[model samples]
Target: MFQRRKVIGVMGSGTQAHRERVIPLARWIAEHGYDLLTGAGNGVMRTAAEAFVAVAGRTGISIGIVPGQATARGYRPRPGYPNPAIELPVFTHLPLSGKQGQELASRNHLNVLSAQALVILPGGEGTRAEAALAARYRRPAILFGAAREFRSFPEAFERLATLEEVCDWLLGVMR
Candidate 1:
């Protein structure tokens, strides 16, 4: 019997790592034998991937969806992609992100669609856009952050204040 390993996507700020929350969450995902998926950039993405990779004897690898655009030379990853922690990098030609993250040109679509479940951290517009896509796609997703960070987000996402709640929600959804 063959079974594919599940992938857990973690979305958040490209500038703020939120290490206090992301490190433990990422390690938990790795320890549980689930692949870690992210935007493949800095901040939360990098932090999560780094933490996931650091876990000893973990079965899952860090998977990063890198955003880029076609140039005269060829396609190139956008600045700060893959962040050294990604064991597998899925490069894309879609360059749009941030305010335009919901657009077709953004790799956020793939990030939201590919994962079995998602964990959202405190982030900016780009993270919000990913959250929107998760809701639109009807994926099992939970926001792991303070209420103020996601006040304007869709009501479908349950905001969790503690890591324990986030882990419980992840276990429920991933199951």
Candidate 2:
């Protein structure tokens, strides 16, 4: 069968509140059979994966993009580098630093472009960078949670305060 599930990229902070919000959103996406793509780190990434796994009869996949994977030693493996919820992990091994290097940029670029749409959760520069890339690539992005605080979104971005609104927008638009 030649079937490609539209991937939904999730960007966000690792805060407790952020994770709390992502839980429901991730479950909805999984229940609806939409694949997911995330940075594959801890905090929000783990929360999303956990939420996806919590659902039954979920056919969607969880893909994690691990940056700075140049080599096993390129970057230290954190406790939850590849969260258990991830069914597949793309180790980019980008030459740039995993945190903030050219490699991270490459990862963010790929994450933003690969997905049909993105649901951005409030985070730091990495999350913000993903939003900027979405603008540069003209990708549809729905900003959720504290990310809405980041006013001045680019032309392609829309700020959604709730998970339901973000999910609805993604399903309605990304089909």
Candidate 3:
């Protein structure tokens, strides 16, 4: 599917994202007119969604790729789970995943494939895994706020110290 709007995937820690950097980056993504795609679980995703919704005159969509069935296993869309700002919530019908990771692998695939680029922030194993997925998918991605240790498939990812550099690169590439 060819999206008319540029979709940028922001990958980072779901539990412990850097508030100062992530929040501003979220707002910037909205302000710059780029659609955002995320796992939409919590933490970084929620922070970005909230910031995007706060900005006025944003010409972007906040889409969440949720994992789980719509009804099976008592799955239901909640207001606060994916944050209240997501305009398009996609239910993957996989499973709520992190460690026991089959569903996570699927969710990760969708997350990487849906976007034109990925912005990686500070994170743990899961974040690392997402980076790897981006590499495998040959998706343009960058790692911010940390060292570039993950083995990129093509080994061409950029490592930036500040969020501004990351944002600049993403905007340039996507635009």
Summarize candidate 1's per-residue lDDT along 1-175 as a digit string, tens digits. Answer: 9997799999999999999999999999999999999999999999999999999999998999999999999998988777899999999999999999999999999999999999988788999999999999999999888899888788898889998998888888888
Question: Which residues of candidate 2, in runs, are more than 4 Å off?
Answer: 15-17, 71-79, 95-105, 146-148, 152-156
RMSD of each: 1.0, 2.9, 3.4
Task: Arrange candidates, best TM-score first.
Answer: 1, 2, 3
Better of 1 and 3 by TM-score: 1
TM-score of each: 0.97, 0.84, 0.83
Estimate candidate 1's alpha-carbon lDDT, on a 0 to 1 scale. Answer: 0.93
TM-score of 2: 0.84
lDDT measured at residue 113 in model 1 versus the true structure, 0 to 100: 96
Instruction: Find the number of clashing residue pairs for candidate 3.
Output: 1
Tens digits of lDDT, candidate 3, 1-175: 8858788888777897577777888888888888888878677887777787788999998999876656656776544556577789887666544553324535777887898989887666666667777777688998776564444322467788787798789868887
Choose 1 or 2, whichever is better by TM-score: 1
Q: Rank the models by lDDT, top first.
A: 1, 3, 2
